[model samples]
Target: MSRPILFFVIFITLLSCDKKENSVTDVQVLFEKVDSIQINYLGSPTVHDLDPLSQRVVFMEHSLSDSGHEIFIADFDGNILSSFIKDGDTRDTYGHIMAPLAIDGENSFMAYSFNGFIHYDFDGNLISRVKIVDFFNPGGRILGMGYGMEKWEGKYFYVNRGSKNADYGDKDFFDEYHTMYLLDPSTGIRESIIPFPENSLFMKGNFFFSRAWEPVFHISESKLYIVFGLEPVIYIYENQAPFNLISSIPIELPDYHYFKGSEKYNNEDVRFFGHRVTSGKISNIKYVDNYFVLSYFPGFDAADTEMSISTNTGPDFWNAMRKKYTTRIAILDSQGKVLNDFVPEGLSETSMKVKNGELWMMGKPNGEVELDYFQLFKVGLTTKGP
Candidate 1:
């Protein structure tokens, strides 16, 4: 090869690599500021869930009216595109169908407990229904449903199922031992990726009912990331037992920071929330990233209650009773070092998804009870020092 040709080839290769690097870096800086807020409802509007299909966002709203809860589709800017009141009683149903609206190719599908699963075309036309029984064995139950059509190397579409249990707690309840399954919707075949464990602690506990399992599973052509939350148990004693009386013992788990637990479980920190108390138990786990984001409600009880009163306390005593306020957010890196902490305003539900160097979040404003609005926020990540 000529000397000039060699130099030209090296220059081209270097430029190509720089372009690829710049592309990734640019995505991290693509975070959009809060341009506006759109309210989907005015009076007592309840947003059951939200899902992203194509570039559109689909959500369900439950309100008080002649018609019951209905599914509504809109754009990311909160422009209502389409809606229809579900026939019959669609209210009081379990599972968050809006989150996992699976877009299989051009068609979208959502699963419900009352009616197995419903499919719709790209234009939101009703397609066929797939019964839960047809896919599972007799006496099998529907665990949970999510919608999104993701394709790997093959022609198969993947859907997830949350395992079901008759003894599972009722509405406004949570089960600690929830299992997840990955299914091939095209063939109606399913395989368990996370199986339900026997004698799950979250199943039998009564002090604090478990909440819905918000299992995060994001898949790309080459990688898959799953995020799940777990709580630790804090035991309580009936009387002044030695274990309960110990204070400031300097107990330390290798990686975790122990905090106070509830009085129900023997009033001991042995169990943090509901599971065995340990530093390793409370940390969030992200796949292959070498780092995880640990999130917890600091001042809230296991029941998610913001306030409580003592039976022995009078009106005046109520004022004297110790109250705890919940801490908002804590961002930790792979080594469990606190990196950032911020109290997000009106943030009820927080979900983070990172793609192409950008962090996308679906955050509900004004807590989950009084607000039915969601805000999508983005933040760019750069190598530059914060």
Candidate 2:
């Protein structure tokens, strides 16, 4: 498989597990009295990203029709405001936007998926598109090959895997100039590169070698915060070039099995991130309600799950692993201290976002309403992330 496809496969495949049937399965009763607004999804919707911009915004593939996947904007009362992009036969149809990077206010947002930094308004109007250069080579010659990006102020932070998945065995591919780039959107030039740490975060596989799977970060005010996909620590920086490491707060995961199983599997010479991040498979983190709330998997035990992607398929111990680990949320204080960790009922596989003291989760509503795919539950947060 190609690199980006493999990245999504690892995320949607390996991490997804069969959920448990709960006694209080009703999403409404589990949280607040507010009724949920259900939005119909097209096709087998891939809820790529979500951001609360006045109304909740979603990027998903909801129908099997020629319309492909679309960007849906909805109000808090579940009213579907509009769907962006025209219908297309294939997913790669140009006008369509897929994954989202950052949402600037309710109108403009930035994303880097199809090898460019694209900006779009909520109405799907094209704002700006900058062709990203290949940072792996000197003088930045190539056109394609860019990963995730987040914009703080006018500078956009661009990151790459530094090495290609297909170039695994090539010695020359390891000599990457940089993995992280500080890009000036106006000039279309890389201002500088944030150097990698001397140590590695790799466990036992090559999966974590790419920036594609590293800590997903957010730019809050003047501070840029980072949370690793497999690590428990939250790193803070002074949102600028040469990102100065301010603090690293360790999230206290409750489950013992969840914590132990998240560490390095063995003494093999792993890559970079394997050694850096230990468990809790952090999926999403948002600054809401003056609190930095994060959602993460409790993580499957390495010994029992045999998590090496090269060796174990995701479904092999899917049930057992999912049963063993609990999907939980860690809420951080304004000063970034661990507030509390609990599993919010009915929070499904889709992305989670908090806005105006309300927590929104996306997923299909059980078995009956499968066609109405893009499901969402808005629960009033007894807390915030701002």
Q: Identify the candidate with maximal TM-score.
A: 2
Q: Model 2: per-residue lDDT, tens digit, 233-350?
A: 6777788656777777776554423232222323244322343232456766766656777767665456643353334545655565556665665556666555555555455632
Assess candidate 2 and give its TM-score to the true structure: 0.61
Give lDDT per model, in order: 0.36, 0.49
Model 1 agreement with the true structure over 254-293: per-residue lDDT tens digits: 1222223233533233243323222123322221243333
- Give residue 251's lDDT in candidate 1 (0 to 100): 14
